[model samples]
Target: MTYPSYRNYVREPVIKVAGTGPARSGTEVWAELDRAGRSRSDRPLIVVDCYPGVDLSDLRKVAERHLPDYQVIDVEDAAALPVAEIDAKIADNLTDDRVFGVLGRQTVDDFYDPDALRQVRDQVAGRTTPVVLVGWGALLVGADGGQPAGTGDAVVVLADMPRWEIQQRQRRGAPNWRCDNGAEDNLRKIKRGYFVEWRAADRHKKHRLFDAMDYLLDTTRLAEEAVLITRDSFQAGLTAAAAGPFRLVPFFDPGVWGGNWMSEVIGLPPSDTNYAWCFDGVPEEESLLLDVAGTIVEIPAIDLVLQRPVELLGERTYARFGAEFPIRFDFLDTMDGGNLSLQVHPLTDYIQETFGIPYTQDESYYLLDAEPDAKVYLGVRDDVEPADMMAALRRAEAGAEPFDAEKYINVFDVAKHDHVLIPAGTVHCSGRNSMVLEISATPYIFTFKMWDWGRLGLDGRPRPVHLDHAERNIQWDRRTDWVTQNLVDQVQRTGAGDGWVEERTGLHELEFIEVRRTWFTGPVEHDTAGTVLVLNLVEGAEAVIESPTGAFEPYLVHYAETFIVPASVGRFTVRPSEAAVGQELATLKAYVRGTERAPVGRPVHDTKEPGLS
Candidate 1:
């Protein structure tokens, strides 16, 4: 899934808290802590083990103001290894590259000084009053990854931060962990988080902290007041939210080549800033906003994958991908903007061998909206030579000359609702004036940008071009003829109902994702079939997603909204909502290739809806 919307897009989608009392906040949070402390016989240890990039400033301020009597212990200052030591420790994962790094496999203890931790432990053990330990690895100071230890009675709280917020913090001059490099390039900061910081944080919490924590703390909106929820309520919120169709709170960011389509269509306020990418369904960086009573509790969407893997991703998917959401849906709005970078993704073997990632990025662009003049660069032209193309790109990058993209690339006229399957190693990018719904495997951010239209980044620096890497991955054999015949408009009408039609869209046989577009005026039956299904309301104003047996509350989806159905959800139905009762709406759904039911029969053609094509 990718990380990083419109139709008055629900800016903040919240899941109703079910089967539990609301989360504790304000003075109520302090009351819960005081009660726990008073009940303990020995010194009480309240440990808030935080993920990297958490705003410890806010946390400390809140703590000092609320629990004045508790002795505050900043673990980083007392026990964390020095920054130089940390750099030396994770240097293997933080490769020399600015934009990429290997996913780390370290634990919280790996970055701590054992002697310093023992000193802190002794200091805590000698305390007669309540001790509040905070920082990235505070829980490890007196407890063995959340279990009982000799540091007196402990109440563990996981101060978790979502990936998107961390990225925002990075952009706004926040360093990762204690590495004092806040002014680093945004790309390098994200790379550090993805490669070292986040992986270590996740490894630290995936089992130990998640299970042992007494409370889950909201580390989002660092500038605002933080919320604290009981661990039981947190788990309940996740369980209830993941059981049915749900949408992760989407994140939008302006890009150098962004467009105004999102602002105009999604009802974002008028601004010069163009919203280029809307991370609608990428769970890795998205958060689930849980509405407890009236307060909104924000938690990472990955919590469901980590805590409810079997239920959210289904048994089969869990077996195949472990605790991970494999597919992602996102938007690439180039409407009224410049073309995206001429980029190519690394192949599976290349990503595995070079980057240590198990999978490659196999993606497809489904047009949600397209200006008539929209042109998509898909593959190499049949007449272009690989060596010549490489030389041209090199010369262009060196500023010796401008690369003539059209001379060597296959540019095609695109339209709304067109599905363009892009397997790895195929050079591709969306041209201006097209709203693309990118559906793909989850390994984003490994793109090799061959060309960027010879423009400097908004930062006034040259956008890094990786022609050397691109040369290794680009599939030269995918010429114009092959692309035209195999990739373009490869749709087949699989079946039809009274008021609905199902068509199999192209994802190519080389890729693992399968997409199905359903055009309907009445209810359309859908089964998860043991795999999580993600979809978008591609061609409708509004539609209602329902569970056949009332397993989930009927969910309303608006035009361009993306939602997910857990594998355990089983069967559900989609129909036009009250406002769209008579209009024919369409949804483009994607899932694992083998998990879905076989097409009803042999393929048929030209069965598209009246407005399509």
Candidate 2:
């Protein structure tokens, strides 16, 4: 649960109008007084009247007698004017920093309805400088019909204008002062509706749980914010109101429901919904959807296929994938000198022929919190005969051309946030003492260990290794170094490159996968398409998400939890807590969709279909 810092002090004012008719006696006088109060009389007043019997010129003339200088535009049949044409006219007249006002019929017999009024209001509400409604009809801005434009307990209405005006005048407040949401300033055109608030947690039970919690809260916060922002202007307006340091958004977790429905009900990517870490506490035998490692839908997070969705704001790219099944795997954590079997993954070509599958296993490492000097074994150091490699494995000995973990494996100093990509053909193994965020094509941990030298698992049993698969797909003829910098000749940090977008945060949209380091100054809006999951560091600020169901409090960075942004949710946003430093808002590792479709021609290995379950 996170609340955006910028949301706390800002107010989104929605003006609701009522009654599509000329103001009767008392109403007309009140309207005139309101107009005068909103403007500087030293300049001429401009009024545009629409429709039969109501003449704005007459009112202008009446105002001129008192002020002596005023301009008024009278259109006998404003309703007859085309909406587009009328909009242009309004735009032209309201140009400049002029103190402007609009008075229109809220309802017109056969032609006007609530929607029409809303459309008209949208054109003028934000632009008319200072506006006052001049009709008796009711306005509806929040909670549908439950609260009329100006009344109800669910909302806060500020009436008693005369008293407020007197107090302001006594204080010698300038006539042109911008109105705050309070009554003393500009009266709310629509009453404040009930807003959901979430609680932010400052601490978590564990410290190493950053990666899992980061994706969960950040993704969830955006989804929640989108719902509130898209549903109502006021709600959208309130999004940035809850300032940061600590904030939370209360929302319903669709994962609480079981099975595939999680993706459908929440409307996020299939990968985004299921995580082994999410259902960790559940009895493993009870048909759990996720595992301790946060492997959702059986699909491991560490892979080349990164599917973190970001909702677009204003205008942006869009893409989505439907849900499918069979994405499953277990994640292993290592300590000290951790060991894994030297393995080979089947490529799309072999999988299709042998398993009747077309998909290839491409995995990547999202190093969450790594220990110093950690390394992973990648490809062989040099080429050797496939037959010789097989003989070495059979004899339980290191092969002649065996690769050194330091030289062949793309070795990095292994900081807390390092990310490394591992393709299908790359033989690899995770070294010791590092927390990892694994993103992969699927959860098929098919490995062929050419040599294990009798390593033991914690259970005091020899760690299992597969050799047949290794010999079949070993790329003996091609064994160049697999480190990114060594492989790519032009690896400058600044200049420019093609194929991907990389920042100091690491990489984004590399190949079909995009990874980003994001910091939000205010609420971030997200939309439905593919599921978006986030791994975030609470650091100092809080992250909150708002949704149609309600608000959720994911809290600050210390608490680790995975937040899922469903594919079906229309949109959502994330904001820092009030005390959050704008310069250091929550840091995030995010994944968004790309235009290149997943390789659909091939089927997945050891299972069915094209997607991770």
Candidate 3:
């Protein structure tokens, strides 16, 4: 049957690297932003509204970590506040005669006394305050029930969701946020760049996204699922389902891979795709499932232009490697009747020999939804002799219930806000009725279903089982003794700082290489040793990148700014405006450091040809 077609389903171009071609180092990227900030030191004031939930804190912390001259304060408690509260707070911190830069809030609307907001705006106007307004939905506030429009010398929206109103208004017949089609206009227009579109999939009508999916399949001749549920039904269910103790939100589409329901849920917008959310457990056997594997936005190279404001286009660099990639995922939930097998992922070597797929299972468990009785199977049950284990496996294969399912698998109760890292070679699976946030590597699912209780699918068909492969790859000799017992360490938020708090995993350490929640008042500093530095904003604030060279322009929160710091560029600093205090901000920092390590190469197991690799 012919599938519906889409007009906007364009596959991203592939990225290439060559000798002295397009690839740049992290140091070079950092220097570019540093130069931008430094060149503007002599300008008047550039007032920046540092809204909450933006990444201002990370900018502040980075400044403090490197340059400590600029001061930060709380807006509510500032002394002799100016007509423009944000300006006054920032101005109070300046002791030099240099042109000032302001970073704080802008309150303008009909609710306030007449001329109040105007007076504040007039005071900072034509001064050094070349305002760069930053916040989510700043462009869609009045129309979409958001805060009223705030005045800015130059408005730049920093959203994690699409501006539905503008998209619907501008793109005739478009189902949702089509502003991206004319992304240049969205960035260049006086009112553009005021809204940061999150996952366009979520805000977009399921039908349009589905139409796009059909067009993609027809164009690429690829096999994929139809839209899981029509937009109307899904929206209705979202309202009904979202009211309870547990709600499931669309964060990522899981159907692009093999998983229809048993996959990861995309939380937050596509830009903030790594953020965690939860799915609850089904009672008895209630289920909440979504088909997501089909809608994956795969791009070959991740450039700065992909996430930066249009104004910073020619000047900003995305990464040291000159590439960034994000994976899309979807999930399903069963309230009860949790049935499953004890499965484990193969090592790099096994994947080469058995699956022909070059991937390792590096995922995390983020609880999204959970019932009181929800639990998860992780690791092994108790110590068992190799001979006895083999015999039990044979019995189970032969229809003899030789061992209790729980005896061989460890089950742990789960709750929300908990994050568990699952590295390669780990034996794990989720329990029934429990919804979780699965974060893993770029590749697809590679499971060696070690033990299944001969269960049947919803179609009365026996589900696909993989006992031989499981036996070949299972790390039986190295299996852990308990499940819940392994979770001894709790994830902690590091105090306000510049660098990231590293988490050692697999053969290497993986940490978000940007600033987390915090703020900076003075010059910002960073030493990214040629690795890609990602500033993921979990809070809101504004910042100026300053170095011994000069100062760069300010950016809003909800935006992830990547600056490649090559091995050559040394130390540098970032400066903030006078109204920098009391602003809330957070970010996740990740970078590959220390003794560099290479990935272990293995053979292809799942391929048709054997001797190729």
TM-score of each predicted structure versus truth: 0.95, 0.39, 0.37
* lDDT per model vs. reference: 0.83, 0.32, 0.32
Worst 10 residues of 3 by lDDT: 214-223
- Tell me the tens digit of each residue's lDDT in model 3 across 1-613: 1111211111121111112112112233223223433454432221222222223333234323332332222111222123354223334322121211111123222112334334433433423422222222222222112223222212212211222223323333222121223323221221221211122212221212222210110001011211112223222322322221111122222111122122222222233112222111111111222222233211101112232212111122223212222221223343333534567666767765543334455555544456677666666556656566656776876777744656666667776434454555566766665555454443333556655556643324444456565666655544454334343134433222332122222111332211222234334444333322323222224343333443222322221222222222223433333443445333333333331121111111222332211
Off by over 4 Å in 1: 1-8, 143-152, 596-613
How many Å off is the CA of 232 in candidate 1?
Answer: 1.3
Q: In model 2, which regions exceed 4 Å deviation?
A: 1-322, 325-332, 356-358, 382-390, 397-412, 458-460, 476-478, 485-512, 519-542, 547-560, 578-613
Query: Model 1 clash tally?
Result: 4
RMSD of 1: 4.1
- Model 3: number of clashes? 95
**lDDT for residue 424 in candidate 2, whole number 0-100:** 61
- Worst 10-residue lDDT window for candidate 1 reads 597-606
lDDT, residue 471, candidate 1: 93
Cα error, residue 430 of model 1, in Å, equals 0.7
